[model samples]
Target: MRGIAIRIHREFQLMDCASALSIEGLVLEMVGAATRRRAQGLSVRPSRWIREVKDFLDEHFKEQINLSTLAKCADRHPAYLSQVFRRCYGSTIGDYVRQLRLDYASKKITHSTESIADIATAAGFYDQSHFAHAFKIHTGVTPAEFRAATRKK
Candidate 1:
């Protein structure tokens, strides 16, 4: 991880009013150190496949994203890609993409005054209905209901 990434994460934790030196924070620090040590000062790591997949997802989240295109992007067999992705992220690619889109939508919904339809489209769901289904499935409430509740807060 970049030093800036670590710093920003620590700053965010502090801003959240959590302990800067909590057990979880300490464990994350140690894990990061161990990872750096294991790299053994190697530059240009062997992350071609995963990096390719991540880039593809980042650039193409708004379309009809599919596993076949991702497998092709990584230049790996579909099964291998699926297995490797699960090992790295503890979730299927579909679930990972959905989570990412929902996270993006949530940030927009909270931070901006965009209409729900616009937010849904911006978050990569092709249509409002699909976005509604996904939002409700993940958050246990429709987007309208979520916005309403947040207003109450």
Candidate 2:
């Protein structure tokens, strides 16, 4: 579990989204195993922790988040925190963060005259290229293309 957390954290810091997502899948598998074990005994409800983490993410999605910091805040191990979050929320933390960033960028694209690079930076992307790649993947269009298409509608 620690190893998985470490790998995911490393990939995330390097901005390797694909690697982070792949490692998160491993975390989900561990979560499934842990769930089965807990089902065999007394299962403690993690509703409060889940809610706290979700709220925190919702508020700070634009910030550079560290799993260790979040785990410490929630008083849980990083792996356990991620496992519980994925199990309950149906998405990895990285995916949720990216979705938040993309959602913000998309809104700015459609509603404002800000340049794509400016919007990307404001949305917490490391670079315009990375933002464009993610935006294309999410919406099937580059940021400029998306803007043009939306403007024509």
Each model's lDDT: 0.69, 0.76
Model 1 residue runs over 4 Å out of place are 1-48
The TM-scores, one per candidate, come to 0.64, 0.70
The best candidate in terms of TM-score: 2
Q: What number of backbone clashes does candidate 1 have, counting pairs of residues 3 or more apart or in separate chains?
A: 0
lDDT of 2 by residue, 1-153 (tens): 333354344334334447657667768966875676466442555498788898899888878898999999999999998888876665678888888888788789989999999999999899999999998876556889878866765
- Candidate 1 per-residue lDDT over residues 1-153, each given as its tens digit: 233233344344334345454436656865776576456543334366776786777677766788887788678899999877765544577877877787678667767889999999989888889999988876556888767655554
Q: Pick by lDDT: which candidate is best?
A: 2
Our model 2 lands, by Cα RMSD against the true structure, at 10.8
For residue 103, give model 1's deviation from the true position in Å.
0.6
